[model samples]
Target: MITFQVKDMSCGHCVSVITQAVMAADPQAQVQIDLATHRVSIEPAAADAAALREAIAEAGYTPVPV
Candidate 1:
C-alpha cells in the first residue's frame, strides 16, 4: 500500500479522475482518496511508485510522497 499527498484534490470529481488514472496504470490497483486530507492511498498488486506517480500526473494532479 502506498499513500501520497495530492494537495489539489478537493472534490468528488477529482477523486474520480485520480481513481481512473491509477486504474489505467494498474487495473488491479485498489485506490482510496481522502479529499479532506488531500491524500490518496493505493494498494497495488505490484510495487511501482513511479508508475503510479506518473499516472497521477497524467490525471492532472501532483503526487507527493507521504
Candidate 2:
C-alpha cells in the first residue's frame, strides 16, 4: 500500500473526491482516507506513486509523500 499526506482533504466531501480520483486511475485500488490525520492510504495493484499523487492533485488536494 502507498500512503500520501493530503493536506487539502479536510472533510467527507474531500474523502469522496479523493476516493473517486484514485478509483478512476486504478479501478481495483482500495482507498482509505483519514480525515483526522489528513492522510490517504491506497492499496493499488501497482506502485505508481507519481500517478497516484498526480491524481490526488487533480482532485484538488495537495499530496505530499509520507
Candidate 3:
C-alpha cells in the first residue's frame, strides 16, 4: 500500500473528497483515510506517487510524502 500525508484533511468532507480523488486515479484502489493522523493510505494496482499526489492536489489538498 502507498501512504500519503494529506495536510488539508480535517473533516468528513475532506475524507470524501480525498477518497474520490484516489478512486478516480485508480478505480480498483482501496483507500483508507485517518483523520486523526491526517493520513491517506492507498492500495493501488500500482505505486504512482506522483499521480496520487497530483490527484490529491486536484482535490484541493496538499499531499506530503510520508
Candidate 4:
C-alpha cells in the first residue's frame, strides 16, 4: 500500500478525479480517500509507488508521499 497527502483535495470532485487517475494507472488498484484529512491510500495491483504518485500528479494535484 502507498499513501499520499494531497493537501489540495478538498471536495467530492477532487476525490473522483484522484480515484479515476489511480484506476487508469492500475485498474485493480484499491483507492481509499479521506477528504477530511486529504489523504489518499492505494493498494496497487500492478503499478508501483512512483507510477501511482505520477498518476495523481498528472491529475493536477500535488501528492506528497506519506
Candidate 5:
C-alpha cells in the first residue's frame, strides 16, 4: 500500500470524492482515508500514484501546504 497526505481531507464527503478519483484510474483500487489525521492509504502499490494524484486534482481536492 501507498500512503498519501491529503491534508485538506476532513470528512466523509472528502473521502467519497477521493475514493472516486482513485477508482476512476484503476477500478480495483483499494482506498482507505483517515480524516482525523489527513492521510489516505491506497492498496495495490503497483497502481500509478501520479494518475491517482491527477484524478484527485480533477475532483478539486487540491492540496495546499501539506
Candidate 6:
C-alpha cells in the first residue's frame, strides 16, 4: 500500500479526479481517500509508487508521499 497527502484535495471532485488518475495508472488498483484528512491510500496491483505518484501529479495536484 502507498499513501499520499494531497493538501489541495478539498471536495468530491478532487477525490474523483484522484481516483480516476490512480485507476488510469493501474486499473486493478484499489483506492481510498479521506477528504477530511487529505489522505489517499492505494493498493496498486501492478503500478509502482513512483508511477502512482506521477499519475496523481499529472492530474493537477500535489501528492506528497506519506
Per-residue lDDT tens digits for candidate 4, residues 3-66, read 9999999999999999999999999999999999999999999999999999999999999999
Candidate 3: worst-modelled 10 consecutive residues by lDDT: 44-53
Model 4, which residues run further than 4 Å from truth? none
Lowest-scoring 10 consecutive residues by lDDT in candidate 1? 45-54
* Candidate 6 residue spans exceeding 4 A from truth: none
Which consecutive 10 residues in model 4 have the weakest lDDT in total?
Answer: 1-10
Tens-place lDDT digits, model 6, residues 41-64: 999999999999999999999999
The TM-score ranking, best first, is 6, 4, 1, 2, 3, 5
Give the Å shift of residue 28 in candidate 2.
0.3
Clash count, one per candidate: 0, 0, 0, 0, 0, 0
Of models 4 and 5, which has the larger lDDT?
Answer: 4
On residues 1-66, what C-alpha lDDT tens digit does candidate 2 reach at each position? 899998878889899999999988888898988999999999997539899999989988899989
Question: Over 4 Å off in model 5, which ranges?
Answer: 63-66
Give the per-residue lDDT digits (tens) of candidate 5, residues 1-66: 667788778789999998988888778888888889888777744567677777777888864323
**Colliding residue pairs in candidate 5:** none
Tens digit of lDDT per residue, candidate 3, span 1-66? 789898779999999999999889988888989999999998887638789889999999999978
- Pairs with backbone N, CA or C atoms under 3 Å apart (clashes), candidate 1: none
lDDT of each: 0.92, 0.89, 0.89, 0.98, 0.76, 0.99
lDDT of 1: 0.92
**Candidate 1: segments with Cα more than 4 A from true spot:** none
For each candidate in turn, the TM-score is 0.94, 0.93, 0.92, 0.98, 0.81, 0.99
Give the local distance difference test score of model 5: 0.76
Measured by lDDT, the strongest candidate is: 6
TM-score result, candidate 1: 0.94
